[model samples]
Target: MGPIRPTIADVARAAGVSRTTVSHALNGIGKVDPRTRERVVQAAAELGYRPSLRAQRLRSGQSRTIGLVSSMPVAVAGGPSKLGFFMEVAAAAAETAMLSGFALVVVPPLDTDPPLDALDIDGAIVIEPDQDDPTTKRLQSRGVPIVTIGPQQGMDLPHVDLRAPRVGRLLLEHLREQGARRIALLMGSGHRSWYVDLAEVYARFAREHDMPPLVVEADESGGEETGREACAELLEKHPDVDAICAAVDAFALGAVRAVAERGLRIPDDVRVATRYDGVRARTSTPTLTAVDLNLAQAAASAVELLLANLKGTEVPQVISNPDPRLVVRESTRRG
Candidate 1:
């Protein structure tokens, strides 16, 4: 019905080289001479030749493929989860995997068992697993070499995470230095490592300071709405609150709006700070102060660690990124 497409054999013949040589040149595999590779490429172009990706994948199997999965659901049409942090992490991980010469397939969170066999993956990087995660269980049962982006409470696995205690201290200290007397925290009710570690540090800080801790926990996934409600509740209970440290950027941004709705000026009436230097934090009114967790670096590290695990080489059980810097902005500063 249509013109017969050219094949590798045709390109090889036209280039006056073996099929193996053509494969090497096309795939950028082994050491092929620069001139020879050029010639082969030219031949393929002239002959309108294309190699079958399916065939190449069948031959390589899981040897050249890896998987990236999230414990949270990602939009089917888009790769990112509800949280922008996860989206940034996934993008960084994909780039790292490409540079490492491996194909990465992102699998969305599902309640049923993942189709691991059908996926053809040698190893996997879990974005952030829960304390009792079924996906983690399935991967472990299948003996998949696994690494995690965020650490968990119970599961022991290779992971890369921020030092939350150190990060928390920096935020609190910044607020206090700005003359905040009664500070409150707005956070998620989740038990993920990030939230858990922050809560621990907050508790310790409260005990040491001999000040009563004020924390408001809610479903942070609702982004600004959750922050608004949580901040409103906190303010109603503690009207003397002079500072707020929100763990999520959306929460911090919403807190800014909430303060304004109540005719309060940020940094003057209520200083505001949060974690994760994303668009919401940077672009919010007064631009909320936030901690730069080095999201891209952390995500890339997860891929590299997973790559090491796939190579059967021993890697450190845990890799913690150091000194997540705090980015100060108008929300926590006096004009």
Candidate 2:
């Protein structure tokens, strides 16, 4: 059987305080004596008392929770690659918000119905905004303070752009430092703003630096197989290509596997680097070298931006831009 739910009266009796004092202490409402409040809190903690979120919402008419709506899949079935980028961003956002006395409730897809009907969130942070994404528009219409993690075309709202071009330059500079004159880019295929920005950056950088602009399509054969095929093809075409820079870490992992299968040494045979350093980068055989996009920072910035908007506070035109720092691992280091 489950443990009994403790009530406000129980806490009040235990603390020798009035039920009203216990209520005010637990909910963080108007003036209650600090000493009494602390005693009440101790009693509640000892009893493992969980305040009813629904009753609190009804009484205060404001939910203390923020919502996160993701457009990416959260899990994969028996696949080497794990959840997509948005999951990481959501987790980071939740962590920061909870630390600041806010609760984060992640809303999964309804598929048939819109998610708005089911939630009473104070504000929302939408991850990876597309040009035609309706969720942003709908939320804006409802006067919900919404922030986007990725690019949102023509929207005059605060956002965080990952600055993909700068990321490409970082990779190129690393390769150049490792004595690799010939380099290729393995990038995501879909025409999302992030990938588009990455391609433009790779092309512009490669030309200015006089490096070969070899591009590989990120096919949907899953990240591993796609990496194997693309890496093999690039190596065969440009045997002199000493480095491969991938925008997605999943693809980078694929490239690493391909390099291993070819009986080639990393950095010496063909150096590999990527963006989106998550589980795969940390756990890969050689430990991938990647640009840590600072997803947690992005999440905090996005939430604070929305909170400012909700409070009628003047917010800057942009909340956060990608300040990517490169994480060097064995994948790009030469022995």
Candidate 3:
């Protein structure tokens, strides 16, 4: 027979704390003193004690399972930067959930009306939902927990969103500093918050600088063809434009093609940059400078927030992601 496993009581005794205190610390009930939580964690680790799944389920009436569902189609291979983002986020979420004795399921968008029958999850994280997103409504109607990566237009659920407006201003400011006088924006056609946020920032910057807002919208997921077509048109209309800000790496790569076809040297005749950073951007010609959204952190935070919600704990209505780093590469480095 297997040796007996340590229980929460054993951990509590080792840490010199009550079972209630141990439970609160282990379950992230919040308001526990930092030193106390650390001691409880150390004691639990030393004793190799994990909360029993059967007991936890019976007590909480939950499966201790979490779901991660992205609005964009996620792929393991042969997709764009956004797909890469989804996979990385999923990996992080799974790790975070497992540490808390929860199983993480990567769920695709549901086709039928009722999706709960498919799986019993305590909560889910939806990435980049639209205004009044139907998915959230349907899930809420069935009493499923949801935490979106980006905010829905009017939904009142907890969400974790990036500082998009700040990122937009930072990008424009970077381009302007690079001697890009006649800069053009390659934006997305979607009405998502990030897109709207960037457009508003671009318009405002144009107004303040007294320069025409050279903007063109494209299918963000159209890969190179969409970017190429959009860039070609932008160039055709504003031939003398000195810089282009592609919305994603796909568009940035296409812009590279379009610029080359017109005998333009990137960062010379025309500088280019993109929003999402990925392998494609790093490997592209003149390597596109892009935004590192810190998707992994965002994903982990979403899982934690959902856990808090499930526990009926009080958390902020809106959680803003505090980390976004800009990686400037060869594409926009004018030297």
Candidate with best TM-score: 1
Q: Candidate 2 on 1-335: residue-level lDDT in tens?
A: 98778888888899998888888888798899899889999999998887887887888766777888764322211144434466677778888778777788876543343567567777888776556667778777876778777767667667777776787778778887988788888876665566678788888878888876888886633656676788888887778888888866767878988888888999778898887787877888888888888888888887777677767798784765657888998888988
Backbone clashes counted, model 1: 0
The candidate, 2 or 3, that scores higher on TM-score is 3
What tens digits encode model 1's per-residue C-alpha lDDT throughout 169-212?
99988998898878898887667787788888888887877768
Each candidate's TM vs. the true structure?
A: 0.78, 0.74, 0.77
- Model 2: lowest-lDDT 10 consecutive positions: 73-82
Model 2 off-target regions past 4 Å? 1-61, 74-87, 107-117, 132-143
Provide the clash count, candidate 2. 0
Each candidate: RMSD to true structure? 5.6, 5.9, 8.8
Q: List the residue pairs that clash in candidate 1.
A: none
What's the lDDT for residue 303 in model 2? 77
For model 3, the stretches where C-alpha displacement exceeds 4 angstroms are: 1-60, 73-83, 108-117
